[model samples]
Target: MKTVYFVVLLLVALTYFTTIEASAIPHCSPWRCQQECLFKNFMKGECIQLQCVCSQKIGGIRP
Candidate 1:
């Protein structure tokens, strides 16, 4: 009985810690990426693989 209780408590603690760690990770959304790119003067922006990817016209030409 004591071992079962300890196991349950350990599982709960592990779950709580994992949730905190997951929430600590940064999130990059498509809209947020676009806004960030626009702020930086980029023509296009997207979130790819949890990262913000920005692109601009080449040689001052609009595309």
Candidate 2:
């Protein structure tokens, strides 16, 4: 009976710790693509596929 109680307590502790870790996990933004680009600092940005991409292509390349 004592061993069973200990096992149950251990399981509860593990579950609590798992939930805490899961909540502490870092979340990523879906709009990672819309972030600042390297070139054309003056250019504007638009959301595409949940990412921030340059509204206008710079030097025939997408910024």
Candidate 3:
């Protein structure tokens, strides 16, 4: 009887877990893009594209 109860409980847990995997995959780049946009403030734009871009500005400009 105890073994039967354990099997039923395991089935319920497995069913619930299947639903989780279905929703967990990365579907598109749009979601990734938005997440990346939020972190833009942390990175310097020049360091990304140019080979010799510096983090420091000549006159402390915001841009």
Candidate 4:
């Protein structure tokens, strides 16, 4: 009986911790992408297809 109770408690604790960790992950957005690009000194930043794309000029020309 004690073993079974311990197992259940452990499972509950594990589930709670896992959920907290999952929710702690940062969600990527267009604004986040732009801020990240600006920090990296990029010319422009845009989010495309849920991905961050940074553009930088090369030799006075845009690529």
Candidate 5:
């Protein structure tokens, strides 16, 4: 009961911040791609930021 209300309030606040304006990406890697990248999800706006990457090498010797 009370806990649910609190959670709703918190979500509202977050929505206001992420909706009213935009925020910057955090340092030390996020959750999406590696390096530095901005990810936008639907009209909801860029809510969650990610910094996950995978390294792969291509063969240079191709006939």
Candidate 6:
């Protein structure tokens, strides 16, 4: 009975965490771009053709 309870509790915890929505760092770029991107709440910070690009936040798993 105790073993069964532990399994059920773990499952519930995993399900609850998985359902939570969050953002992740999909792209990592240069120092300058990264600073600006995170400061502005952008998800992606990259140097595209020698230009710094700040994209909107994308949904994923991030702490």
**Clashing residue pairs, backbone N/CA/C < 3 A, model 2:** 33-52, 34-51, 34-52
Query: Which window of ten consecutive residues has the lowest lDDT sum in model 1?
Result: 54-63
| TM-scores of the candidates in the order shown | 0.51, 0.38, 0.36, 0.45, 0.34, 0.39
lDDT of 5 by residue, 1-63 (tens): 999999999999999888665555343333334322333211121223443433332333469
Model 5, residue 24: C-alpha shift (Å): 11
Better of 1 and 2 by TM-score: 1
lDDT of 4 by residue, 18-46 (tens): 89986786555888888888887787789
Per-residue alpha-carbon lDDT of model 1 for 1-63, expressed as tens digits?
999999999999999888998778977889989988888888899888889999984347558
Runs of candidate 3 with Cα error greater than 4 angstroms are 28-63
Ranking under lDDT, best-scoring first? 1, 4, 6, 2, 3, 5
TM-score of 3: 0.36
54, model 5: CA deviation in Å?
31
lDDT of 2 at 3: 100
Q: Count backbone clashes in candidate 6.
A: 0
Question: What is the Å distance of residue 21 in model 3 from its true position?
Answer: 4.3
Positional deviation of 42 in candidate 2, in angstroms?
Answer: 24
Please, what are the lDDT tens digits per residue for candidate 6 over residues 22-51? 223343358889788888778778888766
Cα displacement (angstroms), candidate 1, residue 62, comes to 13
- 60 Cα displacement, candidate 2 (Å): 19
lDDT of 3 at 21: 80
Q: Which candidate has the top score in TM-score?
A: 1
- Candidate 4 vs candidate 5: the TM-score winner is 4
What TM-score quantifies how close candidate 6 is to the native fold? 0.39
Residue 51's lDDT in candidate 2: 49
